[model samples]
Target chain A: MKRILARISYDGSGFKGYQKQPDARSVQQEMERALAKIHKETSWRSTSSGRTDAGVHALRQPVHFDTTLDIPEARWARALNSVLPKDIFVHECREVDSSFHARYDAVGKEYLYRMTCGEDYSVFKRHFEHQLREIPDRRLMQQAAGYMLGTHNFSSLSSPRTAVVDKVRTMYAIDVLKEGNSWTLRFVGSGFLYQMVRVMTGTLLEVGFRHRRPDTIPEMIAFEKRSAAGKTAPGEGLYLSQVFYEEAALQKHLKTIKKP
Target chain B: MKRILARISYDGSGFKGYQKQPDARSVQQEMERALAKIHKETSWRSTSSGRTDAGVHALRQPVHFDTTLDIPEARWARALNSVLPKDIFVHECREVDSSFHARYDAVGKEYLYRMTCGEDYSVFKRHFEHQLREIPDRRLMQQAAGYMLGTHNFSSLSSPRTAVVDKVRTMYAIDVLKEGNSWTLRFVGSGFLYQMVRVMTGTLLEVGFRHRRPDTIPEMIAFEKRSAAGKTAPGEGLYLSQVFYEEAALQKHLKTIKKP
Candidate 1:
């Protein structure tokens, strides 16, 4: 069997997240169907790094699948893209080690949330950004972010709707970059829980709004109650940016950003 | 009567261009319907800079309409956005003078044609870009562009299917910007013939491929025959960047993009 790794991006506005579920449209289901057509098999299993909810968009969602077909690595990418819907695409594909798994062998993941305080937005970008007409205080939000970083139990930082057992997670970095009225928050960590990043972002936004203090986040984390967190940020602004695996070589697969 | 100007953008894959035609799905028809809803009557008249063909996208397509309603300038932007389809959007809307017209009052227009020679594209951007795996020679294309700039009769550069009687047009600039494997051809002209920009891009692309010489363009222009030009570039990659008007002060009704 040969393993293939693919880096993918999608609008996600029309999908019920990344995972396949009955009675709903999903990127996974569409991808698996496309794969089955390429491999000409009925039982092809595919795995992704994690699940993203309905209406959430992804810039780079890594997935790996094993196949026995004697297809060239480049042909697989072309075939899958040809059969898949226009809204979803597989941009890059390459062969990897047989032991490499998209979810299990992953070391870390990165996410980005884009927020804008503009009174109006271009209809084209409405599906990708969260519009907030009222400007928020950045200084307060930054102070709150400082408290949320490092190792902590994020049970209070997630939604009550989530039912994950283990709540402890380490956040290596959380950087909030602001440019005029637009702000982009980036979070890099080992993994994320159900709606964890969205909830954390909402809590921080409340801090920016002066409804919560930056110093109060520590107590919220200690409470271990979901009610301590702020409202979950809209999924439209969330993006699963990158996934890292220890077994995979990063330099060869990463896209280079050329300076103008 | 109040006049409103709207700057718009769209993914035209699902649209039948920007005109209202009988029994065809057009962007103008959709906008007219939306306007009728606001006016509480079906009678509506609007004008656009020009019409874009099916599957042609736009970064900025200007249009103006007359209405008697007293809606604020910003509210028109928001209101139109709310009712517009997901693939189309109103970027800006402002009140203009009654004499303002989207087509007749135009002084200049700019367009862009993106051509890619990449191995493959991300599935997300496939709709917005044209893919051509082979890199064409840029020097030859640039040399040909120099000859095509300035005043000329564009009769040879248009489609035989067009009904327009006038063929003379003045081109202010034609530039080819190369970034990595993608070459984007930009044109600024006083006006363009039907499918003229696409044909010019296609012919210049042939020059880049060495199939045609840089000097052949002038002969084709002098010939004044539609068959003299190369094939029309695909509509998917064409964008109407901007429209300039002589009688209008652009900043007088600006709601966004602060003036210098």
Candidate 2:
């Protein structure tokens, strides 16, 4: 058996979410359906690096699956893209070791949130950005984002649906960039809880708008309550940009696996 | 009655064209419907800067209409946007002279054509760009574009739907800009005939791909037949970026009309 890894990108507007539900359309179901056509099997299963909510786009989503077919790794992307919908694209594909777990072996993740501050909404970019009438203070938002760095109990930054008890996570970086009328917030972290990025963005925007003080971020984190954070930003502005993993670990595992 | 001039932007994917058709949905139809709601009257007419083909987007499409309503010029945008669909926006609205015509008063126009050459097609930008597997030679395309500049009879570049005998037009500039995997061509000209920009882009792309010679552009113009030019590029990749007019001329005409 050969294990295949694929890097995918999708416009999440048409999908319910990344995960599969009985009646709803999902990214995973569409991918699995396409895979079934290629493998000629109905029982094939695949795993993603992580799941994204509905209306959340992805630039690079990693996934892995076990296959019995012996096709060239480069050709896999072309094959999958031919059958997949126009909104979903398989960018890269490669043969990987059986020990490489798409979810468990992942090191970090990066997410981006885009907001446009202008009175007139851009019809072209409406699907990709959250539009506001007033421009937020970038310096204040950046100061608030600084407090979110390092390790903390991010329970206040997650959704109420998050049932995980251990809410501690390390944030590597939080960057706020403003260009023209657009503001982009980038978050790099070990892992994220359900709707954590959206909540954090919402809290930062409140600080930018002077509704909350920047110094209050630490207290919010300490509260460890979902109610302490601001409202969750809309899903349309969120994007799963990248998934990070150690190259050394991948190389180590590759030595033990047979070539396809 | 006051003549109102407005700058509009729209995602043309939802529109059949800029002109009103019997059974098809058009940008003019939507704008007129919104105007009818504001005026509490069913019959309203509008004139656009020019007609854009089906699936052709616009960043700044100038339009004018006669209204008896006494609302402030600045408030017109806000009022229209509140009722217009999400895909269409009135960017700017102002009172204009009765002599100012949306079509006849225009001095020049600017069009943008986007092409992406890469193995992976971006799902988010798929609707706005034309994708190709092979990267075209930018220098070759630029060279061919140079031949298109200056006053020329563009009859060969126009579609058969163009019934006008006088096809002479002056091309101010044709800029070919390449960044990463995306190539953008900007055409600034006195005016364009039916499918003129698309045919010019297609011919330039043929030159870029080594399918045609750069020097053939002048020959194509000399032929004065539509069949002599290359294929017309897809409407989805084209954008009516800007329409240019003399501010002095507008001001001169404004002095003759009574202010609202």
* Candidate maximizing TM-score: 2
What DockQ does model 2 achieve? 0.71
- Residue-level lDDT of model 2, residues A1-260, one tens digit each, is 89999999999888998998899999999999999999988846899998999999998799899988989898999999988999999989999999999899888788999989965788888878889989889999999999999999899999879567788898877888888988899888889999999999999999989999999999999998999999999998999987878855434433432232
What would the per-residue lDDT of candidate 1 be over residues B144-202, giving only the tens digit for each residue? 99998889888888887878887889887788888887778888788898888889988
Clashing pairs in 1: none
**CAPRI-style grade of the A/B interface in model 2:** medium
User: What is the Å distance of residue B57 in model 1 from its true position?
Assistant: 3.9
For residues B1-260, could you state the per-residue lDDT of candidate 2 as single tens digits?
Answer: 99999999999878898999999999999999999999999858999999999989999699999999999998999999988999899988999999999999898888999888865678998778888889888989989999999999999988979667789999877888878988889888889998899999988888988999998989999999989988898888899987878855434433432232
Could you report the DockQ of all the candidates, in the order they appear? 0.41, 0.71
lDDT string, candidate 1, A1-260, tens digits = 89998878888888999989999999999889988888888647899998898888787688889888888988877778888898787877899998888898777777899888855554445667788878888888878988988889888987667657888887766777788877898887778889998999999899989999999999999998989889999998998987878524333232231111
